[model samples]
Target: MTDRGRTALDTVHAQLDAFNAHDLDAFVATYAADAVIVGVAPDPIVGAAAIRAFYESRLANPDLSCTIDDSVLFGTRWVVAQEQVVNAGVATETIATFDVVDGLIARASMLKA
Candidate 1:
């Protein structure tokens, strides 16, 4: 992997760790100021404030935890992470595609796996 790919993977891992830790500040730090996020259920969320709110609401659930199953790189700027998310005993497989720019997430698109 190139240096950018390594950094992109690091960013994803950091995001996951921060999320599991329920540290909003750390999680938000992984994203760009105008980052765009698209998830399974809701419409696209743009900007840091919207992303923070979205995560803040979901992070309230104590059972929210993510287990990364696999990851593949697309050049140096993107990564596709397949993860299993368990919350309140319900598990969902998610495939998230992250576009990393300058070591921060610029866009994220998620799909059901």
Candidate 2:
């Protein structure tokens, strides 16, 4: 991987680590202030505060956990990740598309699998 590509992957890994750690603050810090999250839940969440709230709600469930399986880069600006979410012993698969801008995530969209 090129340096840029490696950097992008590292950033993504960091975000995933924060999520797996259930560190809401660290996760929110990974995105731009105005970053938008789509499809991670029933409704789209806009901005860091909203995204934080959404994650907080999920984290409130003791059994909630996220696992990222694979990530494919679409050029340098975007990446699509295959993820699995476990909550209350139920497992759901999803695809997450992330738009990276200036080394920080600008937008994230998730689709149920």
Candidate 3:
């Protein structure tokens, strides 16, 4: 992998770690202020504020921890991450697509695996 690819993967890992730690501020910091998030749930969430709300609600769950299972780079600017999310005694896997711009996530899209 090139340096840029490594950096992007590292950024994605850090974001996932922050999310699992329920560190909202840190998680949001990985994204651009105007980042667009899609398919977080059944509905598409847009912008950092909306993404933060979704994450906040998820964090409210007593058993919410997401683990990244795998990540693949489509190009220098795009990546797809397969993750397992555990909540309320249930576990589900999902695929999250991310678009990186200027070393920051500019967009994200999630889908059921």
Candidate 4:
């Protein structure tokens, strides 16, 4: 991988680590201030604050954990990750496509599998 692609991939890994640890602050830090998140709800979530709130709601799951099975890095600007989210003994598969900008995630769209 190119240096740029490695950097973006590192950022994504960091974000995933933060999420699995339930560290909301660190998780939010990996996103741009105006980041957009799709597929979590009917409407897209805009901005860091809104994204934080959405994640907070998900914290209700005491056994929440996210595992990335595969990740395809597209240059330094995008990545497609196949993941599994397990919470409360239920596992759900998801594919998340991330748009990376300046080493931060600018947008992420997730699709349930």
User: lDDT: which candidate is best?
Assistant: 4
Candidate 4 segments whose C-alpha is farther than 4 A from its true place: 1-6
lDDT of 1 by residue, 7-78 (tens): 788888988998898888888888988999988546889988988888897877788999899999888879
Query: Which residue pairs overlap in candidate 3's backbone?
Result: none
Residue 35's lDDT within candidate 2 is 89
* Ranking 1 against 3 by TM-score, winner: 1
lDDT of 2 by residue, 3-113 (tens): 333455666777888887888887887787898888866777889889888888665666877888899888777988898888888889989888877666889998987
Clashing pairs in 2: none
Model 3 regions lying over 4 Å from their true place: 1-6
Clashes of each: 0, 0, 0, 0
Q: Which model is ahead, 1 or 2, in terms of TM-score?
A: 1
lDDT of each: 0.86, 0.79, 0.79, 0.87
Candidate 3, lDDT over the whole model: 0.79
Query: Which of candidates 1 and 4 reaches a greater lDDT?
Result: 4
- TM-score versus the correct structure, for each prediction: 0.90, 0.85, 0.84, 0.91
| lDDT minimum window of 10 residues, candidate 2 | 1-10
Candidate 3 on 29-88: residue-level lDDT in tens?
Answer: 788778888776676676778878878877666688888888898777788999998887
